[model samples]
Target: MRAQKQEWYASWFNTPYYHILYGDRDYEEAGAFMNNLTTALSLQADSHIMDLACGRGRHSLFLNKLGFKVTGVDLSENSIDFARKQLEQDASVDSSRITFDVHNMTLPYHDKFDAVFNLFTSFGYFDEEQDNLNTIKSIKKNLKDGAYAVIDFMNVPHVLRHLVISNSKTIQGITFNMNRRFENGFIYKDIEFTDGGNKYHFTERVSALMLSDFQKYFDQAGLELIDIYGDYQLYEYDKFNSSRLIMILRKQ
Candidate 1:
């Protein structure tokens, strides 16, 4: 019998090295972005929010602190476990207000939510075009009528213009050498590192989807694009100069 092939994200995200490599992500900026986003949406207190593809519950916990009930879901079991552990250790957190689960983004979550957020370039990882469409459809399925969903994606053109082909970073005593390239409508990053005398390699591949591509998916998914922003501050989207492509969609 042929063994099942593991997906890149499933293998890479489950490893402890993934967290160690990206542990320095800016929490303050993320919190500020969340504040801006929630305020813009005019979310009322106690609104139920879903953090789709939430890793380690940073945004989920913050949303809970802002008085919203939050559900954080991710495809990685290890990530969900870490999030649950964090919630368990925090005595100040209201345990009932937030929950985490392992789930595929392409599948419809059982419960609908007032708002769903997929942040930090979390979309476009699937190899199949249908998977991308399915993810949008699932997001629409998870939202109540007239409810909002945000998809935070990287601006492919801008990123390509500024792409650093090779770089190295030493974090937590581990040096990760990364080589990046854009080919065949996908951005590929090959990461190599050595730790405890063992060498490891991983690759991250994301479809280089543009605004027009997303609009097509949104239309097919029966969603309406309500707004577009370039950055976490919610600036107007500019294709040439924007750092990010943030789309706000409403279930139709």
Candidate 2:
């Protein structure tokens, strides 16, 4: 049977809350998250950074404001367009250093960056695990000799501990609903959206890949796991206490 999680976001996330959840997101929390985490990784001031799967340029713009040369890449043309529009309206401290565009995360990039970031559980999308590996391969190709990559992932244990089997919310006159259920290390999400006589629904499932799984993928992609953080506060990752896992990786 087809999983309920794949279409969950697609069907329900195109609304205003979708933009709030994914695109048009304010990264104050996430930017601070990146700042402290990158500091821990010893990121330089003028580093060339790539925000992979960057929706509406949250992290990209954040780093740009912080004086890093940043490139925001994503597969969503709609989101990219929105980001471009937003960037045009904002006055940047280092305007020339920021760029946002559409790109597939699963493919190789042209040049190397000092750092690469995939944040907010935005890394996983494909149905197959190798699909995720392809993205790791792309990241490996995008990093320079000494730079690193960081992935902000959810704490699987926390999710399991605080698993809400179902939930719902409203945004912009649209009713957004979600149902989450896990089986065999996969969290299946079923989502539905309704707005003014129109309705949509889809399913999406993400593998609750463990730290060991991250090790395997990073090793296979010629990347090394140098550090891991538990949350935005930049604390050490513990199985039960942390709500997220932030991993810092380097090319091997």
Candidate 3:
């Protein structure tokens, strides 16, 4: 008998435990990258931007604060809901300038945005390789001519070199035990956590894609890779040691 395969992100991303596990992520670091990226793009205050696969609209909100009209979209209903709530609570944010929606990245959106962003390794979870290409094509379809895109992903080589097999952490009284492995060209993380005497489990799998893979996909989608960065600080990409592979692409 074959084992059942599920879309891990759909379940895990919507879970409260998932947010708890990652709540300590560095916002200052993320904000610095967003700042540098917006400056590099030289986008106007009125430019429309799409935050594809935006989780909770953190980056989208920051971009909006910087004066861009932003739309943040995510497949996770809970995440979108949270983002909307956050937006409502912030009185300083112009409601008309920012919006959040539930969306699947593989679908088309048409020419509506001056820029599109996929940050925080928010890609590469589809079961079919074609779906990944479909996502790139959708990004292209959603952009106006000469519009730009930013994709922030893990550097496969760097991750493989620093892979930690197992670890445990306790957050908010919940103990999370995690195990990691690389198999069949995918890195898998298995998470088991206990909260309030209840045990929950989840897994995340991401394809170990190199720069060549992205170049091929971008070419097929009619996007030109304009620049590559190694980290949030915008250093030149070093395939051997970079902590991240951040590519800036432009739609032709």
Candidate 4:
């Protein structure tokens, strides 16, 4: 059954992962990651890249630093606004080399790029399975004739084996306890946030489609998975050993 996209990452992406993934040390990891990816794709600095679901333009910023013409798109208005602010503050690169736009990824894109990126398990936020399919097609639409697209996702078996079903957090002095559950391919979580003043709760769901299933979507979109990585390094994917499944797809 197809699920509805009720719990999108409009605000949640600005949480810890956002700050952690874009910080200086995080940026170093990102540089290594981009270097690995670009080498695997055999891309040059002149390549045009699209950072799909590019929250706050971190990847795009790095791509721009590498001299790639980058276009970043996301559905979060706040994130986009902040991305623009970051863009404005950046004096190291030519301002026109990097651009950020606001749009839902479940539709066709007007322009094609030499490379397309969907990092950090951003593919499954759309509740309906077809939305994911459309996102692939949309990426295909925006990919140049002989370019590549990459997606990074959590490895299901590993998560199931090492899953912490519940945990508590204190963010900015506000504490929260979270409970997680697995159903079908979705990881459901209950986030109960409590401050000294108030309490709030919310639910989030992320889908889990295996590598083979993703290949099906890639085939539907006229793409082929050329490589797979375990986490940030090139290693074999294991049901329990690998933390992530990073797949690189090329247009056929």
TM-scores of the candidates are 0.97, 0.89, 0.95, 0.88
Give the alpha carbon lDDT tens digit for every residue of 1-252 in model 2: 646453333434334546743433555796787677667777788889999988777778888877788899877767778778878788764668888878878887787999999988886667667878999989989999978999888888888889999988765556668899998878888778866677766677778877888889988888989888888898789987899988889886
Alpha-carbon runs more than 4 Å astray in model 3: 1-6
Q: Best TM-score goes to which candidate?
A: 1
Candidate 3, 81-178: lDDT as tens digits: 99999888988778899989899899986447999999999989988898889999999999999999999999999999999999999999898999
Predicted candidate 1 versus true structure: per-residue lDDT over 1-63, tens digit per residue = 535567799899999999998888898888888999999999999689999999988888888
**True-vs-predicted CA distance for residue 238, candidate 2, Å:** 0.4
State each candidate's clash count. Answer: 0, 13, 0, 0
Cα lDDT tens digits for candidate 4, 158-178:
887887999976656666678
Question: Model-by-model lDDT, in order?
Answer: 0.93, 0.79, 0.91, 0.79
Report residue 152 deviation for candidate 3 (angstroms). Answer: 0.6
Error of 3 at 233 (Å): 1.1
Pairing residues by index, what is the TM-score of model 2?
Answer: 0.89
| lDDT: worst 10-residue window of model 3 | 1-10
